[model samples]
Target: MLSEGQRIAGQYTVERYLGRGAFAEVYRVRHRFLGRQAMKVFKHVGSRAAAEELLEEAVLLSRIGHPNIVRVFDAGIAETPGGRSAFFTMEYVPAGNLEQYWAARGDRFTRIGEAVDLLIQICDGLAVAHGERPPIVHRDLTPQNVLVGFDDDGRPRVRVSDFGLAKRTDAFTGLASARGTLAFKSPEALRYRKGDSPAGDVWAVGAIAYLLLTDTLPFHDDSSPVAFFGVPRDAPPPSPQIRNPEVDDELARTVLHALEPNPARRAADAAELARLLRGWRNPETRQ
Candidate 1:
């Protein structure tokens, strides 16, 4: 097997394992011609039909192009090192996922305005995905799947990643086959509710907003780690000000609204949420 720093496909050099999901493994790689990029190699699909499904996801991501979404540049079930596994190449942001970025900060979110700006961009991107003709629901939206990088102004730029479990809301009418981080999951998701719609992604964005402002997750793992894994959550509204009181109330309220137990009460979609953050002013200070 190719280890860290080894080259695969005779052109791309693997930097390291960035992460692994249920269906695949992600690697930080530098393409000889493309430079730095991320490569997601799926485990053998086990059947021709399954392989077609994985390739379809690649096609779905390629067709749904958005600025804040990770761009998939190349994809094929090429035969090379590591055998006949399927893989797709995408842009690699050096900053890694939001979780690592937050942890490196000593569990503190910096530059309130910058963090909000990042969240707004994410909202716009997700909105584009959800607004597709039939709508696309990112069944799994969490810090681990969201990436953060810096802009020319050194501002934070957020990107959504990992679509292995994504689905078309217009066609899917049953409980999501995929689940994300327990704490960031929507209440309906906990209930195995059917329908993969924009609402679940809204709830996820809300959880991320809360995490970016506060170091802790809105849902607590009070039980033993093993037990907690199975324990259902009654997520509470997390106070961003608990760690940094500097967070604006309007911003905090927006986050809380996204996380409300009643999915029906959540923001309609990413666009609505983005509108709330547009020209954001500290509502608490305005009065």
Candidate 2:
């Protein structure tokens, strides 16, 4: 990890260590003129191939430039305690990630309408990637990957971050090798039956929505032996209303639809799920 106050490429100065994933360490940094940004430095280095792999996330982020997606500002090689490393800088979100946002609510569940609104924004961001000619599937879509902040007016804003495992799907089957968090992964993904696709992303969004509304995961056990054998096809996840009575039938149905074990039966992609969620009318405002 880069120490606090360390400067990189003579442009950004590390403000503090942010976090680390399997392959990279993140730091909050200050740009020479542009204020603060998040710098992700990959652990792997020393080879041309490794550098290319590290640059993939930056390239993908640059390609899919959207307000709902984290914006990439710069990418280059940097010196770290470990050695020379590949790194990229992006916008810094003060509020952290969706997981932290959810946890901040404490005992109270995120309001059903607010949860749905966040999911819509996430879907809108993913739609840009999925709408690509070959379609880019975000194999990983856990809450930790979704950054939550606020807009200029203080309204909640969410940006889909972390495209480390994202990939362009096959033109014909629209699938890529299955890889992501077990709890949020689709049934097909868990079993490696058909690989990851847009439908898989929908399942992830559904899982996040479920957690936000009910404060519980639809598929609770990520470490269960069942995960290795594949989630039981016969046993469906519990309804959201079972945990959160505030979740009306329409909202519950929408969440469940995205969790369908059969990808063919679920909403085709984030775009379709966004449409379904957009149709929901807030209970408090409905007169």
- Give me the candidate number with maximum TM-score: 2
Q: What's the TM for model 2?
A: 0.95
Deviation (Å) of 1 in candidate 2? 2.5
Candidate 1 residue-wise lDDT, 159-179, digit = tens? 887877777764545234436
RMSD of each: 3.7, 2.3
Q: What are the clashing pairs of model 2?
A: none
Would you estimate the TM-scores of all the predictions? Answer: 0.84, 0.95
Give the range where candidate 1 is weakest over 10 consecutive residues by summed lDDT: 222-231
lDDT of each: 0.74, 0.88
> Residue by residue across 1-287, what tens digits does model 2's lDDT show?
68888889999998999899998889999999999999999998777567866899999999999999999999998777777799999999999999998788675554766788889999999999999989999999999999999999988888999999999999998998888788888888888755799999999999898889888888766788887546663355899889988888989999999988888899988999998898885445332
